[model samples]
Target: MGIEREIKLALPPEQADAADRFFSGIAGTPGRDVPLVNIYFDTPALALAGQKVALRLRKTPDGWLQTLKAAGSVQGGLHSRHEWETSVPGEALDFVALEHACDDAAALAALRAAASELGERFRTAFVRRLWQFEFDGARIEAAIDRGEVTAQVSGQTRREAISEIELELLRGEEPALHALTVRLSAAVAGLTPEDINKAQRGYRLCAQ
Candidate 1:
């Protein structure tokens, strides 16, 4: 199990260019752009969601990966969550591995039983740009994502725009993460803390 600490910031569409320029200096080398498709899974009754956890199958250039994220608190755009992920052959979930890695015995048992019933609930497809930086004695990964969260329900589809900046702490003190976000916020205008994640947004869209 891995603990993920990051901050998500909502950005205005028009501010994209300015945000890019602001980080150009701090980010020494930019990584190649990657397009990603993520499918969220859950039982029809949303058992996993009720447990405050989420399951996702992500398709990237490297390949497909299955990830299980445990419930974590989100406040003022700062999120701290526990996650477990492994490479998979396809979009199919490997329940055995996930259940084995889960620390919560009850949650794991429940997931094991519900695994067979899991189905795709929503999806997010986006183009993401990555940059890594060492700031204040901390390693951080800055991701700029632009895409849409699309959900199909009752033979209809709903879509929502996703334009945000995510600063993930690769290895560093938590305070450094906060400091970087504060600095970026000052440089870019109209940036606000985002409490809702992509999965949450997609689920809401599906519900609507």
Candidate 2:
């Protein structure tokens, strides 16, 4: 398991191009656009949600990956969470592999309890423009995600747009995330800190 430290910021859809230009100018190259399809799963009773745990299978250019994220705190858009991720052969989730990858006892127990009853609850499809660079002695990954979250409940479909910037500390002090966020916020107006993650949004959609 690894501690995923990142700062999430909400960006206005209209300002996406400007943000892209800003990152390109600073990084000295254009960002790479990666199309991603993410499906979130939970028990029908939402036991995982109640425990504040999130599980998802993501389809990337490289291959499929399953991730388990445990309950964590989000303060001022800075999210600190325990994450266990591993590559899978297909869209299906591998609970055995996930259990082995997970180091947190609570998270492991939660996965075991929910594994049998788990099913797809919602999905997020987005194109992530990624940029990696060294800033202030820190290796940071900046991503601009543009897409929407969708869920089907009671024979109806619900949707929400996802336009945000994520500044993650790949290897460095946490302060670097804030510094990069500050620079991006200043460069792109209307960028505000977002405390809610995509999983939370998916759960809320299911509730509605």
Top model number, TM-score: 2
The local lDDT score (0 to 100) that residue 196 gets in candidate 2 is: 96
How much lDDT does each candidate structure score? 0.87, 0.94
lDDT of 2 by residue, 1-208 (tens): 7999999999999999999998888788999999999999999999999998999999999999999999999999999999999999999999889989999999888888988999999999999999998998899888999999999999999999999999999998988888888888889999998999999999999998
**Model 1 lDDT-worst window of ten:** 23-32
Model 1, span 1-208: residue lDDT tens: 7889999999998998877876776985545589999999988888888788788999999999988888888999999998888888987888877776778765676677678889998999999888888999999998889999998888898899999999999997999988998889999999999999998998788667
Error of 1 at 44 (Å): 1.4
Return the TM-score for candidate 2, rounded to 2 decimals.
0.98
Off by over 4 Å in 1: none
Clashes of each: 0, 0
* Regions of candidate 2 where Cα sits further than 4 Å from its true position: none
lDDT of residue 106 for candidate 2: 91
Q: Tell me the lDDT of candidate 2.
A: 0.94
